[model samples]
Target: MAAKRDKRGLSQYRNEYLAAIAATFSLLATVAAAGWSSPAIPALKQDDSPVPITANQGSWIVSILSIGSLFGPIITGLAVDRYGPKRTLLLSVIPLAIGWVIIVFASNVHIIYAARFLHGISYGTAYSVTPIYLGEISSNAIRGSTGVLITVMAKFAFLLEYSIGPYVDFRSLAWISLTFPVIFFILFFWMPESPYYLLAHNRDKEALSTLRWLRRSDESSEQIEKEFTQMKALVQKTQHDESSLNNLFARSNRKSLGIILLLSCGMQLTGINAILGYAQTIFSKLEMELNAAELSIILASVQLIAVFIPTFFVDRAGRRPLLLLSTGGSLFALIACSVYFTFDAFDYPTETLSWVPFVSTLGFIVSFALGLATVPFAILSEIFPKSIKANANAVFAMVTSLVVFVVVKLFQVISDSAGTYVSFWIFSGCTACTGVLIHFFIPETRGKSFEEIQEIMTVESSSKEKTKCLPLLC
Candidate 1:
């Protein structure tokens, strides 16, 4: 009986793990879609008519998708909270598939923009909802690892697209991206609703049944019951004062929300997306001049390699240190790139100037993948209480998407007017400041329970409040 119980527990967890991995296919799809056109330089230029897309216009087309993504989190949050992740996830895929179809057949810039916007919505919701679902279902022991695993998969998808994009037509890349949601939609229908969601709606029997399925055995009723009891207690204690958009800025919750939002904003300001979006151009400025396919492969491969740095250290080094290190490293790389550009602008020898920017670009990718890329979602998932996790995640996704949109657009404009070197310097400055802010404000959150993390944030906020309230004499 004891041996059987252990085996059952392992089996249940395996099923849950498989579901988690399947859910991440949405992320993979998002990456593949986002990067599909990035490596198709010849096609992009060839497709242009009498009035070609300027650098800025090209960036705008790419950046406009973020505009759509900005609203996805908020909308999906409400949907997920009301209907549960199962329905929300299933529905989210429709927009992604539709967006791909549009991109695959797009003839005009306007059509591409429309398709991108739709894709943005799907991307935003998936980014927000996946974590909420993962966190709700995962045991605390593996939550952080599971969250990072999704990111790793996302990076791999990006790399895969980059590697293959050059060899195929842009339309084919869109078709490949469509495969994920199709698979996810089919497989996900059979997966269980989040146990937390079931309990939230007072569906005890159903929650238990789902737990049994997740655990892969009908045994361990007592343990499962205990877990449910604890969940019930937590829900009862916190449900009355649960967070909503209106109360997100409430006195008790505002500090945590601020931390999460700032951290998210910091992630974007690190220039990861801006660089990735313009990787081909950046390489050109560096004097490397890789063909579109080669550039894509390099960028994707770097992104894939860099993610491992965080994966190995996140659980060991804690969040704040890794964030600080990555940000600082990125700042250094940006400064190096800027210096190289400054030289090039002044007519420095081509051979010397070229390699400087190339080296710096590699450093920037390393820094980004090591820290900023993996941490934002992980931190967001941890900071919010269960009651507000969905809304908070939505809010985070919206803000991140909006910031990415602005940054991508701004980088393009600056690159067009001021040159790539000057543009990167600005990014460097932002990253340097981000490092400082993270060091001072963000808390370390490795190995802590959800309740413990909440307590830490709560106590820190309370202490700050009291310090502000103290009189001059006291």
Candidate 2:
């Protein structure tokens, strides 16, 4: 009986993990939509390409996703009201699937751009709702690890695009990308909606069912009942529409929103999207002996490795320290890249240091993956109150997409006007300033429960609410 009970416990854990992973397929689909341009750009720019685009046009193609994504999160957030997180996430796959199929037969650049934007809507929804779903379902003990899966899956998708995209025809690649979402919807069909969502809707029994399904069999029934009761009480206590713009600055949640938004802005300013979208353009500008496509693959591989580091450390080391480390390291790496470009721009005899730019870029990606790329997404779902959580995510996702649009467009314009050197200097400045801001403003969220995080935020908000000017930020 003891052995049978132990086996049952293991089976329960496996089932929970499988369900969580299935939900995360939405993330994989989001990334596949985002990363298509990385490899496709090079393929399109090839001499015998079917649709030849200028560098500026290529920038537009990559940035167009931002256009559609600006509206995606809010839509998904609203859909969560009627459909719940699982259905909202399931609905996200339809757009992605449709977009990929459009790409498969796209002959015109405009068609590709429209298809990208259409699909990008799902990317926005995935980032917004996926984190919330994962946060609600995940145990605090493993929240950091599970939350980081969004970033991990995204990087994995980026790598997949780079690896297979370069070698395959456009239609073939599109068909391949379409397959993941189909698989995702099939596997994710059985995963329950977020219990928190069920409880908020007053479906207590279903919430309890989901909670039990997500918990280990070895967990005491009393403990499970206690959790269910707490979820019910909290939902009843705090029930209200928290989506108003005024509530965005409400004394309680303002600080959490402020910090996460800054971090989100910083995430965009760090040039990750620019680097990924224009991997070929950036590599081609370098004085490397290898092909741009090969260099892009190398960078993607390094990025995939970099993205995995935070999963192990995020819960253990805490959020602020890693953000400090990542931003500080990225600051220096961006500066180093600036140095390389500056030297190359000046026509200096720098033949011996051709490797510096690639190495520095690789370093930036490593540091960025360690924290900046992963933490804000994790922190946002943790820090924000459940009342306004969906809208805050919507606004944040919208702003991120907007910032990414400006950054990508500016990258091409700046690289065309002054050079890559100036662009790196600007990005490094953003990193340096963001590092300082994080040090004084960002809170430590490791090992804290939702209630604990809220308590900290409430106290901090009340204390700091009096000051009209933020000392650290100002």
Q: What root-mean-square deviation over C-alphas does model 2 reach? A: 2.9
User: What lDDT score is found at residue 259 in candidate 1?
Assistant: 75
Q: Which pairs clash (backbone N, Cα, C closer than 3 Å) in model 2?
A: none
lDDT by residue (298-338, candidate 1, tens digit) is: 76787778886786678678888878888888889989888
The C-alpha lDDT values of all candidates are: 0.75, 0.83
Which model scores highest in lDDT? 2
| The 10-residue segment with the lowest total lDDT in model 2 | 465-474
Error of 1 at 205 (Å): 2.4
Q: Residue 341 of model 2: what lDDT?
A: 90
Q: Counting only residues 3 or more apart in sequence or on different chains, how many pairs clash (N, Cα, C under 3 Å) in candidate 1?
A: 1
Looking at model 1, report the run of 10 residues with the lowest lDDT sum: 465-474
* Residue pairs whose backbone atoms clash in candidate 1: 12-215
* Predicted structure 1: lDDT: 0.75
Q: lDDT by residue for model 2 over 299-417, one digit each (tens)?
A: 88998899889988998999999999999899999999999899888998778887888888899999999999888877887887777788778888998999999998899899889
